[model samples]
Structures are given as C-alpha cells and as structure tokens.
Target: GVTRSHSRPKVSNDNPYSEAHFKTTKYMSDYPERFDSLAHAREWFDAFISYYNHEHRHSGIGLHTPASV
Candidate 1:
C-alpha cells in the first residue's frame, strides 16, 4: 500500500526531489495538456520515464544520467 504524507496541504518543501521532477515533467515541450485515455497516459509516462532515467542529465548528479550513476 502507498503511504500518505502527514505534511500540511500546499506544502511542497517536504520533498524537494519529487517537486523538482514534477516541475521538469510539466515543463517539457512535449508534455500534453490532457490524456485521451488511460492507455495513452500510461504509454506517455512509460516513454517519459525511459527518457528521464536513461537520457536526461541531472546537474545534481554532475550532469550524468541516473542510469549511469
């Protein structure tokens, strides 16, 4: 089961990593405004995750992809 955070609402500082990732995901030029279907959303996320882990470089990791680190 997924654990729920007990932090107050509207507070994003508790998880800076996820907040940064979400910001990146939303700001992508290819990001869609809406998903046409559940399958579509899943497919999009799969591609995004692949690119994120394998190709995207992170400054926090010295500009290396997560998979390489």
Candidate 2:
C-alpha cells in the first residue's frame, strides 16, 4: 500500500523523492568522498541509517527519533 504523485492527473504517478534524498545525502554537503566505492558506501550508509533511526532527532516527528515515535 503506497501512493506517489508527479505532475500528472493519473493513477498514482511517480515522483523521485527517495532518489533525490539519497543524492543529497551522498553528494551534497559534508558526505564522505569514499562513497565512490560500493563497500565503503554500504558501511557508511548502514552507520548512517542506524544513527538516523535511533540517534538522530527527526524534526518532523516533533524533534523525536523515529524509534521514540
């Protein structure tokens, strides 16, 4: 059960938000340069998601981590 929308009046048109967010994290700001290597990227990404779900403050959740929410 998922729904997404782009610029069309159709049945659940698709937008690329997930891909856009990954690009921002992996390439923008202070992301590591070594992510060009798949193994390194996987390791860092795992660390990031772990911290994200358990440690990071999610503003959209009223400054609570998702685990707390």
Candidate 3:
C-alpha cells in the first residue's frame, strides 16, 4: 500500500519519517511497557493496528487514514 517515492539518493533524513512514527507509537500513553504473554501482545497489536489503519490520520497521506487512502 505504500506509494513509492521517486528514487532519490539515500540520505540520513530518509529514516526520520518512519522513526518518528515509531516513536509516536512507543510514547503513546496507552502503550504498554511490557506484555504478559503472547496472547496479550497479540490483543494489543490487533487493537493498535485497528486504530492505526482505521482511525489514525496519516499526514503523509494528505491527512487521511490508511484505510481511507
């Protein structure tokens, strides 16, 4: 689903965009610091993916949710 950007020469800033998104997920108040079990992790991941795909607005995609995009 990723829209590939025109292939430009690699640079350090290339990673910032993805890294920032990862930081946002990691720093979310509801994100657990630890998971008790595989089941628990799966549950959390499912919920997060649901919200991320259906609700979270991605600025990179013109402020639209991924599901909508």
User: Which candidate number has the best TM-score?
Assistant: 1
- The candidate maximizing lDDT is 1
On the 0 to 100 scale, the lDDT of residue 6 in model 1 is 57
For model 3 the TM-score comes to 0.68
Q: Over the full model, what C-alpha lDDT does candidate 3 score relative to the true structure?
A: 0.83
lDDT of 3 by residue, 1-69 (tens): 889886454775577767767776788779998999999989988888899889988888999998998
Higher TM-score: candidate 1 or 3?
A: 1
TM-score, predicted candidate 1 vs. hidden true structure: 0.80
Query: Which candidate model has the greater lDDT, 1 or 3?
Result: 1
TM-score against native, each model:
0.80, 0.56, 0.68
Model 3 misplaced stretches (Cα beyond 4 Å): 1-18
Candidate 1 on 1-69: residue-level lDDT in tens? 999985455674567778789889999899999999999999999999999999999999999999999
lDDT of 1: 0.91
Q: What's the lDDT for candidate 2?
A: 0.69
Ranking by lDDT: 1, 3, 2
Model 2 over residues 1-69: C-alpha lDDT tens digits?
777854343336545656444654666455786667889888878877787778878566799988998
Q: Residue 10 lDDT in model 3?
A: 73
Report, for all candidates in order, the number of backbone clashes: 0, 0, 0
